[model samples]
Target: MKRIKLALIPYSAYALIFIVAPILLILLYSFQDSSGSFTLENYARFFDLSDPVYLKVLWRSIKLAVISTVICLILGYPMAYILSRLPARIRGTVSFLFILPMWMNFLLRTYSWMSLLERTGLINSLIGWFNGILPSALQLPTLDIMYTQWAVVLGNVYNFLPFMILPIYTVLIKIDKSLIEAAQDLGASRGRVFRKVIFPLSLSGVVSGISMTFMPAVTTFVISRLLGGGQNALIGDMIENQFKVVGDWGFGSAMSVILMVLILLTMNVIQRYESENSGGSVLM
Candidate 1:
């Protein structure tokens, strides 16, 4: 027991100095004004009904994050299912291929997408070339989603899709084959088996994937900056601007605190739902 307590000291101290200290500083700065006096004005500025720009930005962040999460879930769930059903001989190779891009730098990946989405980028250039072979009326319009909300959404989906796929695949691959066989023996159709047995059992992974995907999507400033071009700034952009450009530490910290709280509340709701639904399927 004494040795165990001693072993935890370094880890506990690390957490305190790094995680807990930064959070406490952010919390402290959140409630202070320029003169270092305590004030609610920073939070009030965020929640101001008359000038709801910050609120609008926050809503946009949540909206885009939710859209990204849904798209990831829709696309990832099927991909994960395929991976889970793959033959064991080549499954690792296939999964490695799927996850290969993640080994690259995230910023570099986003920058590559930027090149593709640019007005005169590869996508548009391809459209231009394809148009040369057709009559004017038959020519397709060049892709123009760069610096738009759609661009940001695309970036989110591309970057975070793997996060969604890996978790659900982990769960799906671990599902007991006997339960699935039992469901089939009981005369369940393929779709019915998935609906009744597979999905319910994989809810934990789905919830985890949602949390992982949504949190990063909502908090990301890089994608929005590169793809959104600052016109469609999300809450992340706003928070970043408050600190980096506006030099308003108090407001920035307040936004950070609010964003953290909102994420915690959202996660809590998801966890509560997970808890309620867990084991409800009973392998049926």
Candidate 2:
């Protein structure tokens, strides 16, 4: 145990320098105004509601993030199951296919989708093609969702679905075969087995995937900026603008601090739920 503690010293130092120091700096800067004197005004601006723009942006961020996380869950859970059931020979290949996109730059991956979704883009062209092939009443109209909330959600789901898949896949593959066999021997249908056994076992992974997906989805400025145009600016965009464009570091830091607290609170809720469920699972 002492040797293990000694091995952790380097990582502890690294976190202290890189993580703790930066957070302390952000906290210090968040409480200060233009004159560098400490005041509550920086935080007050966010919650003041007299001008509710920031509050609305934060809410929009949450809404879009929730949508993205839900979509990923719907898609990823099935994908993870399919991947987990694949034969070992092909499973690795399929998993690699999922991971291959990550090798590209994140911005580049997001920007690629713009071409597919934009006006005069492939989707619109495909719709136009369908229109040509069908009667007027049956024609598909051109999609105009570019630079909109839908586009933002699409962008988020595309980028973060893998985060959802990987964790659930990790947990699903680790499930004991005997437990599943025993459930089957008891005459549980596929749905019942999943509901009572597999799902309960995989709750930890689902919670982890939700956390991973929602955090990046909420805090992402790049996808929103590239796909949402300037109209659908999220809280992240607001923070970036404050620091980079508006030169209001104090307010930006305040927003960052708020984002951190919100994420931590969300994580805490998820962990608490996991703990309660885990205890009940053991009891069962």
Candidate 3:
């Protein structure tokens, strides 16, 4: 027992230095002004809409993150289900292939998307070729969605989708085969079996995936900076500017606190939802 407690000492010290210390400093700085005097003015700037930009950027971040999370859920669940049903011998190989892109650099993957979606890039070039082969009116127009909010959302969806998929796949593969067989034997149709038995069983995975994907999507600055162009940016961009450009640490710390609270509240709500729906079909 003494040996095990001693073994944990290094990790405990590391956490105190790296994790707890920074959070404490941020909390302290958030309540202080330039003169290092305590005040709630920085927090007031967040709530009172002293700067309209704060609320606007925050709402936009939440909206885009929600849309990206929903899209990832829609796209990932089907692929996870298909992967879960593959032959046992080949399932690991195929699942590894599904996650191959993630092994590459994240920035490189996003840059590849930039190349594919630019106005004069591959997509538009292919559209132009199709237009040349067809009549005038039949010509498809170029996609000009690059450097827009759509682009940011697309980048987020691409980057975080695997996070959504892998968790659900893990859960699905662990479901008891006998439960599924028993449901079928009891005269449940294939669709009914899925709706009642499989779907309910997988709710935990879906909730976990949503939490994992949405949190990063909401806090992403790189995707917004690269894909959203200069005029369009998220709350993360605002926070970054406050620290790096404006050099206002107090406001930045306050924004950080607000963002942290928002995420914690959302996670609590999701936990409540998971607790309520456990072992039961939401559809029923």
Compute the lDDT for candidate 1.
0.94
Every model: Cα RMSD to truth: 1.7, 2.0, 2.0
lDDT score of residue 29 within candidate 2: 98
Cα displacement (angstroms), candidate 1, residue 10, comes to: 2.4
TM-score of each: 0.95, 0.94, 0.94
Model 3 misplaced regions, further than 4 Å:
279-284
Clashes of each: 0, 0, 0
Off by over 4 Å in 1: 134-138
Pairwise lDDT winner, candidates 1 and 3:
1
lDDT of 1 by residue, 1-284 (tens): 78888998899999999999999999999999999999999999999999999999999999999999999999999999999999988888988987899999998999999788788899999999999988988989879999899999999999999999999999999999999999999999999999988999999999999999999999999999988896999998898898899999999999999999999999999999888888565533
Put down candidate 3 lDDT per residue, 193-264, tens digits, no spaces. 999899889989999999999999999998888888886688899889999999999999999999999999
What tens-digit string does per-residue lDDT give for candidate 2 at 1-284?
78888998899999999999999999999999899998999899999878998999999999999999999999999999999999989988999999999999999989989889989998899999889989988977789999999999999999999999999999999999899999999999999999999999999999999999999999999999999999999999999999889999999999999999999999999999989998999998
Angstrom error of the Cα, residue 92, model 2: value is: 1.2
